[model samples]
Target: MNKKYQVFISSTYDDLKEEREQVIKAVLEMGHIPVGMEMFSAGDEEQWKLIARQIEQTDYYVIIVGHRYGSETEDGISYTEKEYDYASSLGVPTLGFVISDDASWPSSRIDKSDKKLKKLEAFKSKVKSKLVHFWESKDDLHGKVSISLMKTMNLNPRIGWVRATDAPTTEATQELVRLSAENSTLRKKIEGFKTIEQPDEEKRLVHILDDNTRKFKVRRKSDKGRWDDAEKVRNTLLEIFLMIAPTLVNESSSKTIAKEIAFEHVGNNWFRTWPIGDNKIKGMIADLVALDLVQPSKKKHSVNDKEEYWSLTKLGNSILKRARRIQLEEGIDTLEDKSEEDF
Candidate 1:
């Protein structure tokens, strides 16, 4: 899923303006939203409330520590420190960047007040308590920010925003909830019964896939070095579905599905191999949808990407589990015989 995360940037406004710009640029380049105190007037109770709310909504918190301690709140806490503390309290994933001790800096940007300098040192110490990067230059900071955020995001994913158009509709949401409840009931019932009769829906779907007349066509390189139609192959829908079902456990693009299908069905031993043609792939996907075996993925992706993403429906997963799970019986031959009879 291509999710756009919101990053809340915290730092002193004036001294680290250039650094802040770099961080914002990095965030934007990574296709995420960047928010900071630059948007609002500071040092007021109302403004702090608004800042707190914004921090709460943000997915990640990034703090840039420099020479200055920044202006303080009424409680003697610097605004930057307050933002960091609030974000930490809420358990937001934080990325801290502290200026290296050896960094060359102008005397004008350094903290002039003794009290503020002491607070600044304490704040830096607190920031260093966690995993952080030391940077001496804006460019250095930008690179580190991008790399760190990527790693953090991968290690710990967050619920991010999606376009309104891509979000599931009200009716779809309601249907999902209904189906979830039905699935739960069915599972409970299955647990209570040793051998439950197959539902008519499942039987019908299985029949559609099991039909021997259904065939998939492919093209292969000819002896003349041109593409030509290969002999039509007959693979039961159940077989094809089973081959590609695991990849669909997560939302996967059509390209990923094609690769999975090709790798499994089309042998690599062939001089040149091609995945199932797009049209045939689409037809197969549509068949699964008709059987309620798969559905369109609602996860967001980049706007530039045009590939269709798919995920297994509840029924699809249930069917897959039943088909692939090993039997409890210790008699392997007996279990194999029973499986063949059931199929």
Candidate 2:
């Protein structure tokens, strides 16, 4: 009987980082899942498809419009507005929060370009056309979001997700059990007769070298004791997988994975500094997901631990075992930076 709704938080990044964090915290405090594009750009068709799919899956959509209009696509529409339009088209129960016009805000956070400012004004107008809340500060936004969401959910209840164990065992479930038993019998009759082959695309993913490598940028301290310019670092999927596989032997939070990677590459002192941004770390994890190596962990955690968790998939574990075997055969004791040819 426990159901959790998923709420999508859409807004411009960097400028609204604190606001988004507060919103996510508020959603989690309400005991629902909060999903967003914190790690994605939503610029390309493929990215748009992913965003659309996520929006479709969410029970409610929350858009926070601040000063910045956000990065635009080729059509000159900001991705934030694009997301709002798509969510509206689907009639997803929406909650809009716009920064109060009279509120004092950081100049750095405001749009500098005349074009972006125009777009921001238009976007705010479009959002204000609907029932929306105005907030002057992050705390104000958090409080309003919590109260508004509770009321909206009461007025517009949604069929959300529940744990498998929580699902009612009804006649359909009994039918499924019967069908599963019949399927098991059928499988026994044809065991080993035909090998199940992976899809060509998935099989190709295993051999594609380009797909196996990802680049991450990190900022290191310069000789003058100041942060130097960011530099690119590339790692093969196998290398990255091995780097974090130990920590992920169990379900580990994304923050934990980032810490492990940072400590391994940088040092413990700088790991806390997070030489690489969280989004870039998530990009690394996303790559593993594309390779079907890891998946989001569904295990319950305390609400205080807001970070998303991940676990190694069965295929990932198999690959890890194989890699260990190869290491043993090659007398490799520890993971070391190797050329692309090594992978």
Candidate 3:
């Protein structure tokens, strides 16, 4: 809905004519209405009531306090301060603009009267307690008003004025109210669901990797001699992941262990080396993550920023201990669906 908010601009007029004009321009440009005192009135019940009624109707109450302290009441408080008090009491969304300490102005604009200066200082202090913005010059005030008003309106939206014809009918209003309550209820239910812990990563990983290890069998090169070659080992990326995942401790050790596992399992012997390719290792790691077996840590080594690390999850740890105990239990290539790890 295209609604215009009425913002009551409360400030002394004569000393801040330029300031008020800038504020009015800022408010008007943003499509909101600005209300301010055009004529000075005496401190009386009728005048104050009129001002209070205006503040009550406004969506926002803004004040720009300069050096001059305007006419005061019998209680010695400025009329501007009285207006601020009324606005504050009504709980209006108020924005205050105070002149900086180093701001330069004409002698006429400056409050030379010691009593009025003290009251102005007190008023400034009161405004500072709320949402107060600082300004040094007219140009600075213009920019500040524009930015501050934009931000304030976004954060604290008000019940703005609209044409009576544009307003919703009572029946439509009732429907809207019903929908609003239902929406709130649905939001609370969604929030309750958010509190529930997500599915276990470990269990999912173990399921994908269950009994999936590659089988390997070693044979003696000579009839009466010890085994010499790992040539019989299954050459698969899953085998590499199985080899290094269990031994991993922290970030620094995972890569070192991965390379070592690749070299030992893939290379087979000390003399003839067949090093595992980095690309192959990387691809297997990616699959492991997709399976949720291992998660890459977000933390980086202080000395080596580019260093990457991964750790096995809870189920990964259990799976690590179980090794290739697939399902069946006894054979050299065993554990093939013989236990809970089969899942």
Pick by TM-score: which candidate is best?
A: 1
Q: What does candidate 2 score on TM?
A: 0.50
**Cα lDDT of model 3 overall?**
0.67
* Candidate 2 Cα errors over 4 Å, as ranges: 171-343
Q: After superposition, which runs of candidate 3 have C-alpha atoms over 4 Å from their true positions?
A: 39-45, 171-343
Writing each residue's lDDT as its tens digit, candidate 3 over 230-279 gives: 33444344455555654442232334444445444433221111133345
Per-candidate TM-scores read 0.53, 0.50, 0.51
* Alpha carbon lDDT of each predicted model: 0.77, 0.77, 0.67
In candidate 3, position 149 carries an lDDT of 71
Clashing residue pairs for model 1: none
Model 1's TM-score against the true structure: 0.53
Q: How close is candidate 3 to the true structure, as a TM-score?
A: 0.51
Q: By lDDT, who's the top model here?
A: 1
By summed lDDT, which 10 consecutive residues of candidate 1 come out lowest?
326-335
Residue 337 local lDDT, model 2: 35
Model 1 bad stretches (over 4 Å): 174-343
